[model samples]
Target chain A: MATKRIVVDPVTRIEGHLRVEAVVENGIITDAFSSGTMVRGLEIILKGRDPRDAWAFTQRACGVCTTVHALASVRTVEDAVGISVPKNAELIRNIMEAALYVQDHVVHFYHLHALDWVDVVSALSADPKETSRIAQSISHWPKSSVGYFKDVATRLKTFVESGQLGIFANGYWGHKAMKLPPEINLLAVAHYLEALEWQKEIVKIHAIFGGKNPHPNYLVGGVPCSINLNEVNAINSERLNHVSKLITDAMQFVNQVYIPDLMAIAPYYKDWGAIGGGMENFLCYGDFPTHGYNQTDSFKFPRGIILGQNLNEVVEVDARDPQQIKEYIKHSWYKYGAGDEAGLHPWEGETEFNFTGPKPPFDQLDVQNKYSWIKTPRWKDKAMEVGPLSRMLVAYAAGVTEVQDIVNDTLARLNVPVGALFSTLGRTAARGLETKLIVGWLKGFFDDLVTNVKAGDTTTFTKEKWEPSSWPQSCEGVGMTEAPRGALAHFIKINSGKIENYQLVVPTTWNASPRDPSGQKSAYETALIGTPIADKDMPLEILRTIHSFDPCLACSVHLYDPDGKHIHDIKVV
Target chain B: MLLLNPEGYMQNTKINTTLILGIGNTLLADEGVGVHVANYLNQKKLPDFVEVVDGGTGSFVLLGIMQNADRVILIDATIDGEKPGTIKRLTPKFSKDYPKTLTAHDIGLKDLLDAFYLLDTVPKVILYAISIAPLAEGLSLELSSEVESAIPEIVDQILKEIE
Candidate 1:
């Protein structure tokens, strides 16, 4: 048997650059790697700049998820200053976050991830009438209008005719792995175009409140904009209702269209689950609050720290543990102090550029750590994963009845028992379900804003004389927020009222990270170890598993061209 | 050259197909001349279809703009290898790397002519480059003897792009 490898450097459609490499032996994946290719010196740029400007600069690291970075940076500042956000501020932040989820999830499923499964060429073979019937069957999304579908077909036709293939150039259409019949593909294709329009409108919700969709402005103490009675009323009645309706319609579409599509496509490609499912270790910081805004009291999705291949549960980990979190710059271009002293808290951190290749594992684990700019993040000397699947699994295990029912019911439909819902597919499905639940919460948050307005307390903006000296000096604080991908934290120290040092333990740092000092693999990398590399020449299945983590490389801003540098000479003709 | 300003800023002339290329290093310090100029052009409210780009320090990229423009004006901090502030104007024919060390940010411009040649989408091109001596790190521009004196002349040349 012969093996072939197919590598697509700079995976298009997603924000930033991604390089995917798969090792295939006899039509099965023996190995795979998802490499982040772009180098952004955000950490270096942040050094010596006014701490307040970090919110502006760091957020631009990745335009797609800039909101998360901004919120994380602001939270870090708040933690250092030791100022408690007002209740209104909490509610506003929660609403803004919920809006981001609605926008991000919808866009990802339709634009970026959908291309993996939906075949556009197959859509051309579909009957228009049948396409309409299938779309209506899936959900009553207004964008699923027949006229809109026709327009989509026309635009796609022109795009293809133009021969530029802007977004569709890299897609694999004729592969045997494409499972859906022509009509279903046609329906999905139509929805994909409709999704583009719907996403544009949905982004308006971000602009209305936060100033922009990709990156939004949020004040630390409160939101930048004040809520008048009209604005408060409009937020719930118009903007939020529109968003909630989209969510409802989207959930229905997933149930009626996506799941059925996934199952239909699964048998044609039964080898996926076995290939890319890396180490079973899962982690999630948790989202949604049952009652209050306090991080500790609002809601607790039981923390999970899985050890080894046994999948055994251990004690919950703390976010504030400095010893648990260590950064090894040995392989990175950034130089650090001698071994065991390489790790520095965010406030006292030093970022110096030094691009070198792989080195020995930092901790004492027994695995070969290789590839990726993201450092392995451990919890109390143990490598733990972080993302939606982890959060869903922890919630389901703790018997969060809402998520449990959805997972169990979905599993029952799939003919698998409830226990099987603890796997990768379950984690992916949980993200969609969580979006539905969060949409409901957003409606309530909007309603409460109106209530606060009626009580004559719509005063949301606060302008105070802030002196740098007033903020804490020489103190460590953990800033955590549930970024769209997972939990994001910024650890920092302040000395002389300036950022003495800072460290960002981002979500991808946990998911796409390399192995730890103990030689324990990062969650996604560990998951990849057991996955059979199928059809190395066509690594779509491998991509699905990797993208499920939604890795963000901009946060880990160091890059190297190991394959030798010959710029592709991109000509914009 | 004809200058036509919509708001009477250029009431005395007529402007057509003006390609105002702003050049600078967005990541590098004072080298962001193009970005600042582009931002100013965006706010100045030019006529329809006027193209303005944050060209940064990529000269090879200028070939594309050069091919397809009625007129082109470039804004950059030039370290002429002359006196710090001296401004020089020469119709630089294509040398291997006309603008040596084009920044990574605007490297896209390096392949401009190649794109036009392959795609057959060439247009009439013109260029106006400025020589700001100091391209240091930090937002503020540090002008040398001759480079500082060239700002007014550069602005006049930019207004001339529309003319």
Candidate 2:
């Protein structure tokens, strides 16, 4: 009967740290506040540095999105210096980006988000034979034998009974809102383990090209992998073939395991198709360039903005236009030179630390005052959602035939209307659908690279403009990439070949930012407003909506607090 | 035609069975002591089986390296009310056995360990937790002088272990 405030800090199973504070009135979320607990550590680390070496450091900023960050950083530096990459280099970069999408999306669904839908405890009681039968009916992924299902159930039972759930430890298991059947849960659990094995293979594309996986090496002018199709220790036919095999494997995994699992899981929770539909504005700085980054029309994802929930018309998005894209520090722990009310574009962005919040070991944030580590990012002073759903909607609206076919086919298969694309289900489904299309694109990029290499053009690097001496005294440029989470971009101002100011408006900064000066909430907070919490203690419903964004606000200081012991993840007050 | 690299992700890095993994954010002052120590060790000579990795903040991507590794020595900063540079060695079998460090990637490391539980191969992992004060304002690539002073002792301990 009374309004209660529920807080889920360090929301588990995400790439980064996210704290969600929801105001529940009469079992439904009336108001919600989302805070990224950690500051953007890279902002201060990257100031007044040589722009050429940024790719290595920026890639370490996020926990999982090293490739995307590296890509953005290099692209920004290249844009600034006017360093044009060879076709082989661009194709290789596309392949790596595409590989990341396949791996990131699948990992998000299984390891990160699937626990919300499929209960591990429930899976323990499932009939292996039935799970195998259901698996066969939906997908032909070879790990669907009855014995395999039985083994998975046994392993899960052993884990659950071990009194140490570890990764599965923080899950709000057996929540009333968790709707998947025992067999389906078991099937999902089986794939969760298998997906981990499959994802490691995907990153080899990064290693083959970038030199390593965790923090791969990157050059400003072009990719590090030089091409020599015949040499044993080069980007030869063997390595290219290896890339091809990874792409083929990814295609099969997405088509068979991921898409089928999504369809199978969607019918059970069609109610979610209407819930957690946040804003009407979506923006995407499209990626996978066919004609190069400058040509938006050649982008496989297609660059554009959809305003007021209009799927028919898309407005142009200009990241460089100082008026078009801007960031505000209001309702955030950052301060701008002009003031809180003024939104500065990325080129003029500031990294002033202004921590003004309640000390930790506290209950809730001062919502009326400054809160959250993420700065509010805006497109022409309007809050916009940017991610897989944003990308899909923009592509589908722009009449990308492949995206349309998949979107239409998915809608028809689920028998849901087009409006359902606005909700939590839509966001989650969009990621899988986009992954399906990207794998196909990955194949095309691979083929194109092979064709070019076979035509005796093995040039992957351009020495022109690679030196800092070639640049003007000062120049500014912006590099945008569609990260697995959303539209991620970096803007840099180079003065005399040194980075005067560097600003990264990441996916999480846009999605998880707090209220603006005008009191407008970002995607994460807005999506949680109407979510009905079945039980206040275990807010499974809240995680469903929040995790849909694939919130990647990581790099939280990994402080080992022994005295101030805080055990619970979701604290309700 | 995926050419099989017998060595794991470390084929790019020096492929080794023994790994000295450092976990931290270099941007933070003392928080990056692990990486600082790893960088210090990377310059020095060590056993051929050992590979020093700046496992900056620990991600799922590091699992590729761990899959091939037989033994891992991890160094990270911890806030346990001890002296700023006090070192504690721990042999953690499961993710639950370690101290609850609060980073999004710390969760990933724990999840990475938990992921190993799902697989048949589990690497033997040892952690050297360096005690330090809580996070402070103003980011710096340089470690605090006090924390920086303790690196030699930590490096000596690591050298003895590898020896």
Candidate 3:
């Protein structure tokens, strides 16, 4: 009957610094505040630099989704200069992007988000033989043998016995909220370890194409890797074969392990299908361009906005229309030139440090004031949720038969209604389904790339319009992509050959933002409202919803601190 | 058995290549010290078998490169409640020996080491942890003066490790 505030600062297993405060009344969260505590002056650092070199610097925004920033940065420059990349280059970029999606989603599901569901300590009690039986019953993955599971169980036992949990140290093991039985928990634990190894093999595609993973190389006009049948250093026949094998391996794992694992785990936690569905409006700047970047119809994932859970009428997304996508910092820790209440288009976006909240180690945030470094980015002044769930729902609504079939089949299999597809479990399931869809598309892209190479089309870069002299004196461009977390856009204003101003509104910035001038709560905050907290102290339920968004504050807000001395230090355990 | 190829450079005749990996964000002030030290070492004429890579906050991707090497020297920014620029060199035998948190990535290099340990492919690892102030909200590309001065010593420590 009493209102109590519970805060989870620096939510572990997420990419960057995030602090969440929720006021719980009668074991239900009534109000919530999401804050991104750090500021990365990445946009500030990009000013006055050559627009061509922007990818190398901007790619450092976050380490996990490394290549997405590079891709978006190069695309931004390309869009500004009006350079159409070669078809071969387009196919190669698509494949690389697909590889990143598979790798990111798999890692997110197993390593990052899975711990919130599967209790690691409970896995020690699971019988290896029973776990193996359940694993085999679910999926046809080859490592589902009792002997293999026994070995995995032994390794996990040793880890638990060693007293040092390492990455698994702070998890709320054996919590009342953990739903999985010991056998299923052991099965998930086995797959979690397998996924770590599986991810390594998938990233080799990036290394083969871009010369490295994490921060892969990208060019404005085209990709950097050239297809040469004879050269050892280039993307030759031998390397292409290896890339082909890796795609097949990734596809098999997604189909055999990832999707099966999601389905197996979804039924147990179907209650989550009714929780954490925030800001039903969804936005996606469709990706995987078949033609050039300008042609939206050629995109595999079509660009659109699905508002208020209305799956029937899908509205077209116009990134160029300044009114459609504007960031409001009314309640964010940023000051706008026009005033605190005014919304600014990213081209005219400004990053001014204005920390107007209580200092660190505080009990509660001044929720009515500036609370987060992330500004509320509204699509036509409406808070829009962007991620796999949004993308999948939009695709399904648009009658993309593949997306529709996957969503329908998944819901049917779980025996949950269509309305249930809008919650936290739905978000997690959507990521798995999207990975499955992307892996299928990767095979087609790889085949198309091979076909282009066989036709003696070795062209990868367009060198004609690369020089600054060939450009207009002033131009503005918006580069948008469906990053692993969600919709990511980078806006660039170029003068002569240099970047005059740059603004990036990443995916998490949309989902994890604070309140706007209209006093509307962010997607994360809205999702947290009415979330039943089983335990106020452990608050694993709050983490379940937040982790579902796959929050990456580094990508959302770039740098921290204007004054070098007063660093906000909050002790996180 | 050093041999000269067409480029006429002395190549290391040793079979096992020692990878010197510098992992951090170069755009972040003191956090980029490992990359700075790596770049400094890259300019020097080291052994051909000694490869220098600026990993730049990469997590599992570095495992492929790490597994290929017989030994590795990793340099990154670490905060252990030490002075801002105090350089600490350690030979970490297990993942627990590595710092609990890293500046840029959530699953730090320690997680990667744990994976390597699980796979039984972990190489001999030596770390040069240049102490930066603990994770905070400040922005600068230039390293603190103390961190900048420790670069030579850090590189020296890495050179000694490889030798």
Interface RMSD score of each model: 11.0, 3.7, 7.3
Q: Least lDDT summed over 10 consecutive residues: which range in candidate 3 chain A?
A: A559-568
lDDT of each: 0.53, 0.83, 0.82
How well does model 2 score by local distance difference test? Answer: 0.83
Q: Give me the overall lDDT of model 3.
A: 0.82
* Model 2 bad stretches (over 4 Å): A555-568, B1-16, B102-106
**Candidate 3 lDDT over residue span B1-163, tens digit each:** 0111101111112237777888888777888888889889989989877888878878877776677676788888876668888887888787666664444355657668877766657688877878887544545568888889888888887777767
Candidate 2: give the clashing pairs: none
lDDT by residue (tens digit), candidate 1, A455-559: 777656444424676665555556677777887777666666666566677777666665455555565655555454334445566556666666566443321
lDDT of 2 at A217: 76
Segments of candidate 3 deviating more than 4 angstroms:
A38-40, A556-573, B1-15, B99-104, B134-138
Write the number of the candidate with greater lDDT, choosing between 1 and 2. Answer: 2
Off by over 4 Å in 1: A1-6, A38-40, A142-155, A212-214, A230-275, A287-294, A299-315, A340-350, A357-372, A418-424, A461-465, A532-534, A556-573, B1-163
Alpha-carbon shift of residue B7 in model 2 (angstroms) = 5.7
Ranking according to DockQ, highest score first: 2, 3, 1
